[model samples]
Target: MTSSLRERRRQHLRDEILAAAQALIAERGYAAMSMEELAAQVGISKPTLYSHFSAKEELVIAMATQAMERLFAVVDDGDPPRRSALERLADLLRTGVQVQMDRQVTAMHLWMPEIVQMMKSRDESLTQLCRIDAVVVDLVRQAHLHGEIAAGLDESVVVRIFYALFMSPNVARLSLVNSPDPETMPDAVAHFFLRGVAAGKA
Candidate 1:
């Protein structure tokens, strides 16, 4: 095949493999998934699957990276003047939680141990994560400087606390069991955080 054709074929195959893996993860938890089953589901040979992803860990990392990219895109597209930075930050957190509740997202997180191991071995993915973390931290800091957050609050601590709130098991449990509307969760989190951080409120 021509180089262009080869590249297109490769892209198509990768998409198929990712789709199959996501479906499998949704049907059966990530722990139960297997590369062989994924290859079969993608209608590709094991060797072909290996060519695309080498191992299950690489595939999961790619999936997570894709999800994070989507999340950042959402945050980037947010309207700023209409909403405070804190509101935008809350929106980002809510987006992260909703992504986690998603089957593909859950699969990625469920497979995170192996993913972290892979990052340890390769070392590149951690850099990407750090870059993303820095951006998030900066956003929080800017919010405080802009008076969107109280002056006395520690930006770093507030950012960490915001993340913790999203990752809290109670929030995840509420998301999974109650199936609370995704749109509502952000507002709720923002309200709670804002009240605590409001200027002159204490």
Candidate 2:
């Protein structure tokens, strides 16, 4: 019982650290966020922060891994055949954007060149990103097979389009535009993406 309690406390601290890291990364770009500021924000000593994550790169890689794992969970939600691939893709994109909005960041910021290069150096984080790509690739292929997407459209191009739409910064700045309400922003984005990539009637 004592051991379990200690493990839980350790996990809780780890979560707090990750949350602080995300907030800091949102406030300042990855290049500007510092471990000192993170430790101060989390109310933990530098030594304690070091104990949880040996370095900033490790912490940010862990953050990227966690974010990918979260999206993977949504992707693997066991209802693949019940929904259209296009619908599932849109929903997944919506969830991704909503999650980033909740974290006070955008997908583009989290995936800037600096962060992407660092993530590439980490095998675990890279693998998680690849898994997500594979899933999206399969969805794009399904979308093609179902005639929901243009038959001649390259699957790779469609996949890239999906990422591009998902990475739009405008979704995070809804209030600044004459756009739909926050509650409906996800739906609006999904609709916009779908229409742009629809099979016909362009």
Say which candidate scores most in lDDT: 2
Model 1, 1-202: lDDT tens per residue?
Answer: 7999999989988988887887887788677999999988878889989999998778777777766776778566765546766766777776666666564345335335566566656556677567667767877877888887777788878877876766642345546475555656656665676677656565
Tens digit per residue, CA lDDT, model 2, 51-92 = 999998887777767667778778888774678998889888
Error of 1 at 107 (Å): 5.0
Superposed by TM-score, candidate 2 places the C-alpha of residue 131 at a distance from the truth, in angstroms, of 0.3
Candidate 2 accuracy as lDDT: 0.77
Residue ranges of candidate 1 with Cα displaced over 4 Å: 75-84, 104-121, 168-171, 174-177, 195-202
Could you tell me every candidate's TM-score relative to the true structure?
Answer: 0.78, 0.84
* CA lDDT of every candidate: 0.70, 0.77
Model 2 Cα shift for residue 110 (angstroms) = 1.6
